[model samples]
Target: MPSNTDISKLKELYESLDRLKESGEDVVAEIRKEINNIELQYLKENLFPEMMKTLSRKISWLRCSVDMNLQFNGEKQLDYSFCKSGSTVFIRDKYECNCPNEDILEESEMDSNNLEIITSTSNQTDAHDTPKRSKTYTLRVEFPNGKVFQGNVVSDTYVAVIKEINPEKVDSVGLSHAGVAVVSQTLDSKYAKYQKPIGGGWYVMTNSSTKAKGFDLKTISDELELELKISLVPLNNSEEAIPIMGISESERHRIRVTFLDGRTICPMKVLEALVEVVKYAGVDRVRELGINCCADNLILKNPAPRYKKLCKPVGNGWLCNTCSDTITKFNQITEISQKLNLGIKVELV
Candidate 1:
């Protein structure tokens, strides 16, 4: 059987077929064919490979058992060897023969080499054992409009989770990167030891000796005894980020944001959250909220160096000092939400 992750993907794919049908697209047959291809891919890449590994281990164990039984029963010494052909393992015996059959001798030599390779693989498997099964975790996605979507997802890579949650936007490079970064940051904060900081500011999470790009969401969920809730916020286009305490310095650690319509942008720093709000609320509306437009410190056309570090470009060659503590950012978001009549929420996690 395919893993839960693969099953979820298939389910989503099937659901999309229904959506396509409703949209009057005649590609239902094409999509069904694509689904079949995906299923075959999953079988070959995941299920079949896993089954082969298990079968190989069992065969090795049984062969050893048979050899021990033969020796204990006082049977004559017999050569036991196996060769892999395609997906099958063939066991054969090599006996001493004075016959001049060159073909037989060559086949025996090939089988012997295969046996050695299998033995080495079996030894390595014994040392490492099988990989741990991925655990299923409850996933909750909170949209900016207070809408919530809930589902069960397997503990896998951040990219995989996003694909399951928002399959439609998986192809969007900006949203995919933003979603992965948000999920990675949350996992890093909770399970720092399991996360490896790789190039491009991405974090790979794993519990095994081998490095993996997927974090164990099930472990975190189990520890907290709660479903993993991901809040989608909004961000401006020109927003940038600055590292703060207890957060990763990587650019990928930027807080993920999306438009109210669910279009996501690149994640930005807390300092840029205010810029996003100001852009959304319009400069005139922001000034109406008791903010001085001519001030050289905070929201102004030209700011001093001290305040400039905390500022970001907000169109029309204007700069706004949005860089501040998390609490301040939250308060600003709240204020903008109230004054502009927008339901905006910016959370650090």
Candidate 2:
């Protein structure tokens, strides 16, 4: 790797660990947690589907939408609940945001108490000047533990409270004003540019006094249960998505995508290249990890027998479960092969 050493959430993460260590929490526990997070058998290292499953609390990451209430100043903003769905979602700041409302006029505890609707009117001579946006974003984050907290994210430039998180335990994930952007996949390096998703998601709240009030998620109200669901993509982040079309597969010939690291990646995994603005190296072109520098480079195997156990034999290579969709053709080998081919290849290590 041009850059890669150890996994550390950030300087703040280490500081949190120090705090936890002072409290008698084993630091080794934190290290092991990171390893497990990175080593999880993802859909070809595709963090989106699994993330969707974890956030949505569903078996399959295929559903279209979830039940969520988007209230503005106290009234529902959208005509219907969030009906749009995607592979991933983002809760970040964007300059050209057509996303409903960028600024928050006012925010109160999720209640029907006294509320007001405020709009801006420009009565100045210079019409080129944009109107003043809201100053504060009252952020009320509810948890599965029947507990809710109130806070705010600055309108234009702001950071709530950033803290470290265990990637393995996303169910207990919550939102706070703290500025930590996302839950990283590693605790080895502090640089977030190389974070698992390449970009962060969780806003790590680090105020020592800001204790979580309610108990951990236990019995969630049926009405609030849907609020926990997360779609495959956030409506805002979908704009940059690359379309994966005309996917073809077969037993005699196949296609799939793979990273330069030789790790298998699902279809959407290709879109991840957008994070670094790099051209995706299809599976067929990428050699296994350590091909040029390792002594095992020349070695080859007859995986015809061993590989079948892991994936269905297709075209010239075995298909990964993530890339192979046997949705309709269970018995047809060619159909299965064609369906499984992701226009990628894998050189076994």
Candidate 3:
């Protein structure tokens, strides 16, 4: 039989083990908290915008969940019906697909906790803390380069939505061109659809909504006579800066383009050219082009082939040849006919 001292020592050892286990658990909980912080920062920095999630409000770590869904052959279906269904559902973790179709799709986790994932949603809630309710829409476009960009659509107004659509089957788009339209549908299905010039820019809206059904302006015209309000939404990265392609913003607002010399312009052509330059040479090159502001000024001043400037004096101002001609047109300065004779009398007063 063990002595009293041995029993006491055994009890002390058990207490020590208990303390160690508690300490180990505390350390694990602390590490988990740090990991959550890192994950939240990464989502805020990269995932939210890329995924097209409305981030008007702040998300709570305890209350937030990472809702996700699976799409097979372009149709969304439920993987686990137990998961919540709502646009504003807080997904505790990312989605996982362990079904036989795993080879068709990929699976990933949002957190170490492995929380349940949402498959689909019919409604949206304020993910952010903002009081205003926002709806989520999708904007799909097939680019001229055979590339397709589909994501969340932002912008409450139709004009803003059109601007958000990316370029399609073309290099550039411009609003300043003779035939440019930022309308809701196709152009010619009606009475030879014409472009109407509006104050900020030109729009191709119809009196009836029937013409706005199909994506094509002309085809939509054949169906509906909807009232459309097209306008020049600022473009930074497409051809002629016109609506050759569509662009969309989160809200219907204007984009301001600024030059290096603090000069701002909203011309559709210039915006298109700027976008083309960026596409070919890259965005960094665009910044370098802005740095070369003098070159742009030269292009503006010389709008003709072999355009040249002649120096001339006007009323207290030095005008170029073009300005000089306009000022002296009425007061014709024919020639200087001051003839001085060799023996001319010198009149001294």
Better of 1 and 2 by lDDT: 1
Give the distance in Å from residue 141's predicted Cα in candidate 3 to where it truly belongs.
Answer: 17
Per-residue C-alpha lDDT of model 3 across residues 1-349, encoded as one tens digit per residue: 2223333443454445455656776655654554455445545643455446453344343342232332222133323211222232222222454455333212222321222223223234557745553332333333344544333321223233334342221112212112223342233344224433222332443232211311343222112332222222233222231222212221111213343345443332222323322333333322332322112321132322111212122222212122221112111111000121112111100
Please give the ranking of all candidate structures by TM-score, highest first, separated by commas.
1, 2, 3
lDDT of 1 by residue, 187-304 (tens): 4344555554443444443433211212233223222333444522222223232111111233122333455777554344455566777788776566557643224334566554
Give candidate 3's total backbone clashes: 43
In model 1, the worst 10-residue window by lDDT is 65-74
Ten-residue region with minimum lDDT total, candidate 3: 329-338
Each prediction's Cα lDDT score?
Answer: 0.45, 0.27, 0.29
Q: Cα lDDT for residue 296, model 2?
A: 27
| Clash counts for all predictions | 2, 44, 43
TM-score of each: 0.26, 0.21, 0.18
| Prediction 1 TM-score vs. true | 0.26
